[model samples]
Target chain A: MLLQFIIGLVFGLGLIVSGMSNPAKVLNFLDFAAIRSGTWDASLAFVMAGAIAVTFTGFKLVLRRPQPLFGEKFHLPTREDIDTRVIAGPAIFGIGWGLSGFCPGPAITALGFGTAAAVIFVAAMLAGMWLARFIANRPSMSGIVTPADRVGA
Target chain B: MPATSFTPVASAAGGALIGLAAVLLMALKGRIAGVSGIASRLLPPYEDREFAGRLAFVAGLVAAPGLVWLVSGRLPEQTIEAGMPVLVVGGLLVGFGSVWGNGCTSGHGVCGLSRLSVRSLVATVTFMATAALTVFIVRHWG
Candidate 1:
């Protein structure tokens, strides 16, 4: 628990330092034309590249071992198929991200900043999660990912 | 185009920190540090050995800024351009889409891609393109 807490703390601090908690910064990052026009902002490129670089190296170094250093097994994603779930979910999520300029992690971490906007966004996010759970029950698009999904999930 | 009004150094540093956190969680707990997955699993419906760690992680995430303020004497600046209605719709889309996609930037973008998962690659590319298009439409055309 302590380990996880420390990780979370570091991640949160990282968000702050990365300027991700600042929605204006994020909003500008999504503005492609502004990015091309050199007017708005485009810092997320660095963020993504840096994060991916580190994780790419770390995972390469660690995955070769029989298992994780502290745990019995590694819990990576299991599903590989690019089904409807893969396509539609992220498309919708992308639209939401563009609209609010906040994704899950930044939105959650921003709550620590005590913005009423963050508070409302978080509440609606949770509600939306619950609504997904309810929607996942229908038989047609069965096995859909949602409020209850995870693990190679 | 010359960069303006964006701090690449800060973003890279923070991204590095986030990557380190993901590595730590995976190496220590044998789990992917997907925020939505971890946060959702903390709710009542899911119960397991992982619950305590998940809760603690989320608590720490939610408190880092507060701690920074207590120590550094300043809260990080934040701005959400979207109004309440827009935020609500956006939040719902994020919640539902992320859950439906089975991961967000953290899960698929960071963790899955690190492992070189093809599904993650597809998901990431798809979302990024859609996000860019969405932003273009909303900001420019709309």
Candidate 2:
């Protein structure tokens, strides 16, 4: 638990230092107008590049181990299917991300600062999460099922 | 929006830190550092023995800015152009979509890409494309 907290702290620090926590900075990067205007902030690209490089190397090293140091198994995603939900879900998320320039990590990190916007957004996000599960778990909505059908019955 | 300065050094350093965090989480806990997944799992119908760890992780996330403030003597700059209504709607979409999609930037963009997952690649591209388009429409046309 202490380790998880420390990792989360580091993750939040990265969000802050990378300026991903700043909605304005993110918006500026997303705004194509800035590109035409010669004002595009490309910091996000650099951030992702740096992060991916480290994680790529790190994963190669870690996956060599049969199991995690503290856990019995590596709880990585096993799903390989390219389903509709994968495509449509991210598309909708993209629209929201572009609209507000706030993703889950930054919003939660910013919540530490006690900002009204962060508070409101985080609350709404949690509510949305619950609602999604509720809808997905609904037997009537047979087509839309939770990733794990074990949520409730 | 006006011109904004790029912070290559800080961005890269910060990103590396994020990657390190993800790596550590995987190495120790054997779990993906998907913020949304870690957080949302703390909610209903998702029962696990790691509940305490998840809560502590989120608590740490919620405490990070304060740590920064203590060290830097200033709060990090965070601007939200979206009004309350927009924020609410956007939050809803982000929550529902990320949950449904099974990942977000950190998960799909960083960790998934690092692991060379085709599904994650598709997701990252799709989200980036739509996000760029959405921004173009909102900023230029809307």
Candidate 3:
């Protein structure tokens, strides 16, 4: 438990230092108008690049082990087929990200600031999550695997 | 106007830290370190045996600003441009969409892409495209 907490702390620190925790900075990166006007911030691209570079190489080395140190097996995602939910869900998520420049990690991490806006966003986010589960639990939606029922779980 | 600070070094360092965190999680727990997965699983009908760990992870994340303040002598500046209504709507969309999509920027963009998952690649591209388009419409055409 402590290990996971430390890992999350590290992740949160990364979000802050990378400027992902700052919605205004994130918006500036997303704003294409800034590109033409010479105000665009491309730092987020570098953040992703650096993160992917390290993880890509790290995973290659780490997954070679028979099992994780503490667990019996790696519970990686089992599903591979590209489905409509995959497309539509991310598309909708993208719109929200563009709208507010705040994604889940940063939004949660930003709660450290104790801002009312962050609190409100998080509360609404939880509600939305509950709503998604509610929709998927309807009798007609049975057998359809929403994210609530991911293969790993 | 909010100024965009070009912080390549700090951003890269931060990214590396995040990658390190992901690596540690996989090495230790065999988990994906997906924030949405971790966070959402904590909600109702809670069945995860690892609930305590997940809650601790979130607590640590929420406490990060305090860490920064301790080291830097002040909280980092954050500007939220979206008002209450927009924040609420956008928050709901983000929460719902991430749950419906199965991941978010951290999961799909960082960890999933690292594992070379085609599904994550598609999700990443789709979201990036739609996000860019949304920004265009909101900032330029709105």
DockQ of each: 0.62, 0.65, 0.75
What's the TM-score of each model vs. the native? 0.91, 0.95, 0.96
List candidate 1 segments past 4 Å from native: A137-149, B1-4
* Top DockQ model: 3
The 0-to-1 C-alpha lDDT of every candidate, in the order given, reads 0.80, 0.85, 0.85
Candidate 1, DockQ score (0 to 1): 0.62
Per model, the share of native interface contacts recovered reads 0.73, 0.74, 0.74
lDDT of 1 by residue, B1-142 (tens): 1233778998999999999988888777778888877765654455466788888888878989998898889987777779999999999998888877777888989888888888888878878888888878987884
Model 2 chain A poorest 10 in a row by lDDT: A144-153
Query: CA shift at B88, candidate 2, in angstroms?
Result: 0.4
Q: What C-alpha root-mean-square deviation, in Å, does candidate 2 show against the real structure? A: 2.5
Q: What is the per-residue lDDT of model 3 for residues A1-153, given as tens digits with 9 covering 90 to 100?
A: 888889899999999999999998888888877887888999999899888888888888889999989888887887788988788888988888898888999999999999999999988888877777677667778667644435221
Q: List clashing residue pairs in candidate 2.
A: none
1 or 2: which has the higher DockQ?
Answer: 2
Give the C-alpha interface root-mean-square deviation per candidate. 2.6, 2.6, 1.4
**Can you write out model 3's per-residue Cα lDDT over B21-113, one digit (the tens) per residue?**
888888888888788778877887665588888888888889999999999999988999899998999989888888788888988889999
